[model samples]
Target: MTLEETAILGCALQWPDESLPFLTEAGIRADTFSHEIPSAIFTAIATAWLAKAPGGFVGIATALGDRLDALGGAATLQTAIEGAAQPVTLPHYAEIVKEGHSKRRLALALKAAYKQLTTEPTGTVLAAIEAEISSIAAGRDKARIQSTREIVMSVLGNLNSRTDGSKMAGLSTGIVRLDEETGGIRKGGYWVIAGPTKGGKSALVRYIVRAVALDQAKPVLVFGLEMSSDDTVEAMLATEGKVSASRMRDGTMHEMDFPKLQAAANNLALAPIFFRDDVYDLAGIRSYVRQVKAIQPDLAVVVVDYLQLTEGAGSADRREQEIAIVSKALRRMAKDENLAVIALAQLNDDGELRECRAIGMDATVQVTIEMCEDEPGARLLRLRQRQGKTGVVVPVVFNGETFEWHPLAHEPEPASGKSFNRKRK
Candidate 1:
């Protein structure tokens, strides 16, 4: 009747009633009834027995009564049986009957019991438990093999998809020709918008963010490392309100602009766009991405103000090396999160102006905007789409006030004159 004897009996009688006589002949019953058993142990044994038994209520009740008598009196046995049954609900009992009590179930039961006993779910304790589960589930030995295969397949898929250039979302950049050529900017791409100093990189990113996040109502996260959160918000307001950046800074908005500004502010306040001014290194950025994914799993895009400003964990021989690392991370994050990451990158100085190029072969599209002094403050936007090629090219004017790109009209190419008048020799 002791706990140990009851456990032995439970295990021995677990299979069938056919085994019980053998167990009794082996002195199991004599040993079990020699000392008083814990009621809990007796209840567990009786439950296990009844679970496998085909007997009706009379047989089960008889066994239960005998076990209760061996484990002290009926009241003590009933109390323990009630306590044990409280933990195993009808659903849980059914599950145990179906799948049997696994180690995982036992652990879960222990955890639930601990939580019930403590009456608290602190972060540290919960995290430890979660970590244990994750670690067990990870199967570390297979990680390297699985990771290698995943990377290979991902790269291959990207390569195969790149042959047919990306489709762009309709941006309000007014550049009909550029939009026609490159589609808009495809989702799930690391779009590098690079230009020289004062070349309106930030403005361009702001334009895209507004066009995509506001106009399209797609959720976006803007990581503004260079600008403060307030400055970024002000820039967005300026773009949305069609006010000049200078006017916003100087607080010298025209009387007519007030209504537009008020409307922009109201819209912005309710926008599903999120902005973070934290100067995150690559690791920090990755962590932020994970947090964002947990909350807004359906995020449409992420916009990093510029790549060069962000820090990463590498001792690059040059700044480009660091930029490459950051670029790859952004691309990977975009693919993993299934969101478009439009990152602004700074171009290396080429004479007086820096021009944009696709950072790596991973990018889905690349766009370069050049400001021309010949036309007296006209801007030319050139696009290089990764997938398909469309023979469309034109000049686009950047409206800093509204942060809009307006396509400029161009004259048709002059017809070449032929020397038909030349005498044949």
Candidate 2:
């Protein structure tokens, strides 16, 4: 048995109540211990504690029952007692034990990756490795038991970090009024943008991608499930360059449109917008994010072009549960990765979400687009916001030809079709 694991187990049995919290908080479970005795002992002690049994030998044995007897019971208990350290050092020993566990898991992951390399795609293998390593790393961030003062102080610090409350509190959405109302797209936020077909949900995502990735120079990721990566980029070019989509689609662009397309492509070539339309499952999305995050740790946004198309953990017949799983995972991923996750959703003609309501329940902010005859264009309503004001309406003007959409107050006119590469032949 590793000394650290044995020592930590000893500490837990000695003062189970005091030590269990630290061990669990440090991400230590039975699996965390490599050795036989330590793992069993930790499990037994945990079982005993959960049953409200005493921390003493008899109580733990009663709680763990056959578990202890199967592991050489009293003799093992005595051995742990002899090796026991004080609860004061529990945290230190827990850290050491956690490190050992991570190393063990890392080795296993590498071996598995190696075995699969001959059969798996290179990117798949790499993504698995990346996700496994990231999981290990995340285990180190122990959840703290915070006092009210500590919680308040943390909130204040977050507020102060903004530097100026007069501006949007989070990453800017590039729409001024929306930012003022909803405080921009917050880090660790799960935002659901819902609309019927051709209501400009995808357009909004593209606008945000361009705003954050190009204008703000922040990294952005997009998963366009309905469109291929190349086609998505062409669509972006059409909107951003003021080139006609039909013309681009047919390779029939006029002479003047060439520079505009070239300029758009040039701007996009190096911009930190990573697009992948191949991913159709949540695991793939998670793996892709983990891989991208390694390089761009500051990646700010993730857009799932439409939610219903993505596969979740459930079976084909259980669509609702599957969507719930997908929705919850997206929200959790946003929190875990500290980025804004914008998941577009399909809406019915009556403006209800086409699929699961769990999408809205899991969202920090949920907005839907609808058209009103009295309104000049579409109306985007903030139906729900967990952290801010709701029922706010933003007037939207969308140019279907240009694929440009924005709140009326902050709408920038469509690109002027200006030619670039002056002084050329």
RMSD of each: 22.3, 20.9
lDDT, candidate 1, equals 0.56
Give per-candidate clash totals: 7, 0
lDDT for 317 (candidate 1): 71
| Residue-level lDDT tens digits of model 2 in 313-418 | 6564778788888999999999988899999999765456677867878899887765544444644444468877766666677666567766665422212321
User: Which digits, one per residue and each the tens of the lDDT, describe model 1 over residues 40-147?
Assistant: 443334333423333323433455566656555555434433333221132333233223223444377457647745754465455545555454344211121123
The lDDT values for all models are 0.56, 0.75
Clashing pairs in 1: 1-32, 1-33, 1-37, 165-387, 165-388, 168-184, 168-185
What TM-score would each prediction reach against the true structure? 0.55, 0.60
Question: How many residue pairs in model 2 have overlapping backbones?
Answer: 0
